[model samples]
Target: MKCVVSGGNIKILARAIQMLSKIGEEMFVQPQEDSLSFRSVNGSNSSFADITFHENYFSYYAYEDLDESDSLKCKILIRSALTVFKIPSLINKQIETCHIQLDANSTNLCFILKYKNNIIKTHLLPILDCETIRANYKKEGTVNHLCIQPRVLNDVVQNFQQNLLEITIEVLKDKILLRNYIDETSNLSNETRTQLVFGMGEFDEYKINSNTTITFCLKELRAILHFAEILAQPIHIHFDCAGRPIVFICKTLGVESNLVLATLNPDDDLGSQSTTHTRPNSVLKNSAKKPTKAKGKIKSLSKTVFGKLANKYPTNTNTEKIESSDKISNASETSSPNNNNKFNATNSPRVNSAKVIASNSNTNKRENDNSSKQNAFSSLLKRKSNQEIHSPDGGDKDDLVQNSPPKQPSKKAKLIFKKCFQTTFNPESLPGYNNIEVEDSGESD
Candidate 1:
C-alpha cells in the first residue's frame, strides 16, 4: 500500500497524527480502495479515535494488493509516526511531498519526505502485527446533538482550570451547561466547583429530544477541540445519558475524524460520599440533615451489652422446676371433692421456704438410697438396646443421620452419658494412665 500526501495537505495529516498520539501509544494503519483509516484506542480502553482520509486527501494513492484476501494491515508506534511530522509549521515550506509505503512482506513502514532544494528525509519504522481496532457505536439517532464552531467552544473551555480532568454537560430545552465534574471520591472541601451556562441560541445548530447530563474526560475533548480549530470546521456532538459513550464528529474537505469517550455513571458511586453531587438538590438538603452511622453504632452497642448481661445472670433453673411442680400439685388439690377453701395457702405469692427445702432434701435422700452404679449402667445399656431395635439398621440412632466414618454423637446421647460412671471408672486402670501415674509417684518418692 502506497500513498502520497501533497505538501499542501501535510500539515492537516500531521495534525491528525499529533492528535491521535495524545490518546494512545500505537496507531493501526489500514488501507482500502477508497480511503485509508488510522485508529487508536487509549490505554484504559475507555476512549477510541478513528480518522479516515479519502483518496482525494492524497495527491496520489495506489494499492495493487487490494484484490488479495489478506491486505496489508499493521500497527506502528505513535512516537515514530509523530517524528515524521514533528513540526507541522515547517512542513509547508520545507517539504514538497510525503510518501508512505508498506509492502506485504516488508517488516518496516517506510516514509519518504521530499524536501525543498533537492533535500530528502527517509524514516523506516518497524511494524508490529495487530488486528484491526474497531469500536461498535451508533453515532446517529441520538437524542442530544449540538453543532457549533470549534473556536467558540474552545473559548468556553478556556475559562475552565487547565488541570481539570473531567467536565459535565447538562442538556436542557432552552440552554446547555458545561461545568467541571468534581468526583465524589475527591475531597470536595478542597476542590473548587465551576459551571458555565450557554443558551441554545449560542450554538449554530442545537437539537434536544430529552434533557440529560453527561460527564466525560476533558483531556480528549480538549485535544479534539484544538484539532477541529486547526481544521476550521464545526464539531458535531451526539450523546445519550450518562454511562454511555459520546461521539464527536469533525468533517472538512477530505478528512473525517470520530472520537468516542465513555461517560461517568452516578450510580457507580451511590453508596459513597460522592452521591450528594448526583442527587437532586432537595435530596441533598435532606441528606445533610440526617444523622450518620453513630445512631446505628449506639443501637448495636446497647444490644450487645444487654445480650452479655443476660448471658452472665442466667435465670434460676432450680426455682423454675420447683414452681412448675407446685402448680401441678395445686391443680390436683383443687380438683379433689374434699377441697372446701376458695383460696389456698400455696396460691399466695409468698411461700414457706423451709417446707420447700425440707421436701427437696427428702426427695434427694430417697433418690440416693435407690440408685447404684450397676443400676445406672444397666439402664444405659437397656436404652441403647431399645434404640437399636427401633432403628432400621440395628445401629445407634445417630448412625441414621450419618453413615460416614467418624460420625457425630447425638445431643441426647451426650446428655444421658454425662457423669454416669465417672466415679466408678479408675483412670489408673488404663495402661497409659497407670504408666504416667507410676512415674509421677516414683519421682515424688
Candidate 2:
C-alpha cells in the first residue's frame, strides 16, 4: 500500500497519531481495498479509540493490487510513529508529499517524506504480529444526548478545581451540571466540593430520552482534550448510564476522531448510611480561611530613633555609618597633636592630644575635607620629588626623600552625640535652653 499527504493535512494526521498514542502505547495499522484504519485499547480496557481515512481523504489513493476482502495489518511502536511527524512546521510549509509503504513479507514498514530543495527523509519501523482489536459496545439505547461547541464546554470545565479524581455529569430539566465526584465513602461534605453548572442555552442542541447522570475519570477525558485543534468544531456526546463508557466524536472537514471514556461505578449505600453523622472539625475546616504568606517584605533604610524627641534619621547619616562601621576604634586614629594641627592648619597646634569626634553633618564634612587636602598635598610632594630624582643632575634627591612626613593614620567616623538642645537660646547662652540644666547656687547673706 502507498499514498501521499501534504499541506495542513500532514499536521492533521500527525496530531491524530499523537493523540491516539496517549490512549495506548502501540497502534494497529490496517490498509484495505478502499481506506486505511487505526485502532487501540488502553491497558486497563477502560477506554478505546478508532479512526479511519477513506480513499477520498488522501490526494492520491491506490490499493488496486489487493482484493476488496484482503486486509494488510501491522503493529508499530507509538514513539516511532510520533518522531517522524514531530516537526509540525515542516508539515504546513515546504513539504511536498509523504509516501508510505507497508511490507507484507518483510518485518518493517518504510515511510519516505519528500520536501522542497530536494530534501528527503526515510525511516523504517519494526512491525509486531499483534491481533487487531474489535471492541463490542452498544450505542442504540443511549438516553442522554448533548451537542456542544468545543470552546464553550472547555470554558466551563476549566473552572473546576484541579484536584478532583473524577467528574460527574448530571442532566436535568433545562440545565446541566459538571462537578467533582467526591467519593461518598470519604466522608467529605458537599460544601467543600466544587461544581460547575450551566443552562441548556449553552449547548447548540440538548436532548434526553430519560433523566440520567454519569461519572467518569477526569484524567482520561483530559487526555482526549489535547485535541482541542479539532474542537473548533462541535463535539457530539452520548451515554447510557453509570459504569458504561461515554462516546465522544469530533469530525472536521477532512477527518474524524472517536474516543470512548469509561465511567466509574458509584459506591453503594455509602451516602445513605452517613446522613445522620456529622464531623464537627470538618465543618470548621471547611469554613476556615486558607493562610497565605507574603512573597517579600519591603525594607526602608531610614530608622526612627527615640531620644528626648521622636525623630527620623537622615539617609546620608545612615550611608556613612554603614560604610565606616567596620573600622571605628580609638586605634584607627592617631592622638598626635602635631598631626591634628597639620590637619587643622588654621587652628593652633599643642603638645596635648586632639580627641574631638565628628558628631554632626557639618563637622563630618569639614573633617573629611581636611583629610582629603592633607592626602593630596602628600601625593603632590612625592610626585615632585620623583621628578627631581629623574632630573639630569638629580640634585637634593636624598634631602627630599628624608623630609617627607610619615603617612597619616586612617580616618575614623563616629555617630555619637555629645549634647542635644532645642528651642531658642539667648545670646548669653542660658542654662535653661541646654539639655544639661545648671543648678543655681546663692551665697547666704
Candidate 3:
C-alpha cells in the first residue's frame, strides 16, 4: 500500500494528526479500495475520532497487491506519527510533501518527507499487533442541533481556564449556556467559575426538540474545534439528553471528520437531585426483602413443631391421677390386719418396738424389703395423729382406706406381676422381723 500527501494538503493532514494525538495514544490505519481510514479512541474509551481521506484527497494512491475483499489493517504509535508532523506551521513552510507506504509482509511503516532544500527525511515506525478500535453511536434524530461557526465557539471556550477538564452545556429553546463543570465532592472555595450565554440569533442554524443539559470532556472538544477553525467550516452538533454521546461533524473538499464524545448526567452522581432517582432505592428494596422471607419461614416452622407436640401429649391427665389414687387405697385396706394391729396400739409396747427398730437400723446398713415395709407402716401411724391425709376425690384418706373391702387382683394385674414373684424363696417367710418378741398390750381386761 502507498499514498502521497501533496504540498497543499500537508498542513491539513498534520493538523488532523495533531488532533488525533490529543485524543489517543495509538492510531489504527486501514487501507480500503476507496479511501484510507485513521481511527483513534481515548484511554477511557469515552471519546472516538474517525478521519477518512478519499482518493481525491491524496496525490497518489495505490494498493493493487492485495485483493479488494481482504482487509489490511495496522496499528502504529501516535507519538511516532507525531514525530513526522511535529509542528504544523513548520511542516507547512519547510516540508513540500509526505510519502507513506507499507509492504504486505513488512513490519515497519515508511514515512518519507521532502524538504524545500532538496533534503529528504525518512522514519521507519514498527507496526504493533492490536485489536481494531471502533465506536457505535447514532448521529440522526437527536433532540438538539446547533450549526455554529468555529470562531464563535472557540471564542467562548477561550474564556474558560486552560487547566479545566470538563464543561457543561445547556441547550434551551431560546438560548445556550456554557459553564465550567465542578464536581460536588470538590471544595468550591478554591475554584474559579465562568459562564457564557448565547442567544438563538448567534447560531447560523438552530433547532431543538426539547431542552437538555450535558457535561463532557473539554480536551476533545477543543481538538475538534481547532480542526474546524483550521478548515474554515461550520461545525454541526447533534445531541440528545444527558448521559448520551454527542456528535460533531466537519466537512472539507474531500475529507470528512466525525467525533463522538460521552456525556455525564448530573442525576447519576452519589448525592445529586431526585430526577429519575429510582435505581439506588430499588437496590435497597431488593436487599431488604430477603431477611423478611427467612423470618417468616422460621415462625412457620416453630408453629408446626408446637402443634405436633400438643397432639402427641393428650389433655386427659386428671383421669390418670384418680385411677392411681384408687389403686393405692385398695392396697392399703388389703394389707394384713395383724400388722396394722401391732402398729395401731398406743401403749409402751409400741414405744419399745420403735426402739428395737432404731437399734436394728443402726446395726445393719442393708436390709430386706420386709424391714423397709415395716418402717413405712410405722411412720404412717405416727404421722396420723398430727396431719389428716386428703384423697384426690376430697374424701378423708384414712376413713376411705379403712372402710374399703379387700379385693383380689385382676387377671391383668396377676399376669403383669407373675414374673416378679416367680422365685422359690418367699420374702415373708424369712424370720428377721417375725421373730421379734413383743410385750403384752396394756388394755384393761
The prediction achieving the highest TM-score against the true structure is: 1
lDDT of 1 by residue, 113-181 (tens): 999888889999888763455554556777888898989999999988999887878789989878786
lDDT of 2 by residue, 1-445 (tens): 8777766677777777777787878886767666666766565545667666667678876665654322356677878888888886566586777877775555777777888868898988778753454333433346777888877877787886666556778777699867665553343324356566699998887887666666665665665565645536677787766545587777665565667666543321111111211233332222220100000000000010011001111111112211111122132234333322211221122111122211112212222334477664565566455532222232222212111222345322222221224345343564455565566678753
TM-score of model 1 vs. true structure: 0.62
Candidate models: Cα lDDT each: 0.64, 0.53, 0.62
RMSD of candidate 1 to the truth, in angstroms, is 31.5
- Rank list by lDDT: 1, 3, 2
TM-score of 2: 0.56
lDDT of candidate 3 vs native?
A: 0.62
- After superposition, the stretches of candidate 2 with alpha carbons farther than 4 Å from their true spots are 67-71, 139-141, 161-165, 183-192, 267-445
lDDT tens digits, residue span 1-445, model 3: 8999977688888888888998889987767665777778776556778777888889999876755323356778989998988877888788888998877756888889999999899989888843344444455567888888989989989999998877878788999878776544344346675668889887888998888777778999999899888788888898876655788988787677778776653332211111221233433323222222222222222233223222322221111221122232244334534222211211112121112110112111111212476684565555455343323342222212121122456978898777567787465765684665886778856
| TM-score (C-alpha, index-matched) for candidate 3 | 0.59
User: Lowest-scoring 10 consecutive residues by lDDT in candidate 2?
Assistant: 292-301
Q: Please list all clashing residue pairs in model 3, or write none if there are none.
A: none
Which scores better on lDDT, 1 or 2? 1
Q: Which of the two candidates, 1 or 3, achieves a greater TM-score against the reference?
A: 1
